[model samples]
Target: MTTQTSTQAQVIPKFGEQKKAFSIDKLKRLVNAAKSMSDFDQAKRYLCSYFIPCSNPHGVFMWRSEIKNLEHILDKNISKLICSITKVFYT
Candidate 1:
């Protein structure tokens, strides 16, 4: 007996057709869409930068986190949102 596994290809949207500025709302929407499709979008790798201590220069170095797989967020739902927000805190 022989067995085989089939694979499917993902269709990436044709972006860059029109020049446009990056919008936080748009990025968030696209990332959310990609999550439902079980696909990976390079744009999901954007970095989030914020200052700690809920202050400006008074805070230490800027805190940064890589926006990894949307699955992490999708799995946790709002809990992940809360955690990501709390991560802005300093060590």
Candidate 2:
């Protein structure tokens, strides 16, 4: 006798087929606003959501793929913003 659990697996949704409520631009802006604020809890909330697998699954994969994948999605202005923000917070 063979018991197979085929339907138990969660298939990854298509790249563009995720819910409309999930906005990449909104997330980026939230991260920026969070970074500007002085509240640790608020900032942590935004950043953690972006970097964590639960909220931003693609983000975790992109971050894991290294700088190339991230840079490709970031574009010129976003890259600049990231650089500026990092300079402010990291150094």
Clashes of each: 0, 0
For each candidate, give its TM-score against the true structure: 0.25, 0.24
Per-residue accuracy of model 1 over 8-80 as CA lDDT, tens digit each: 2322233222223334554454344443333224333322222123233232222223332112223324333
How does residue 43 of candidate 2 score in lDDT? 35
Clashing pairs in 2: none
Worst 10 residues of 1 by lDDT: 1-10
Model 2 lDDT tens row, 5-89: 2211223233323333334554444445443345233334433333333233232322322222322232333443334332146
* Candidate 1 RMSD computed on C-alpha atoms after optimal superposition onto the true structure: 14.5
User: lDDT of each structure?
Assistant: 0.30, 0.34
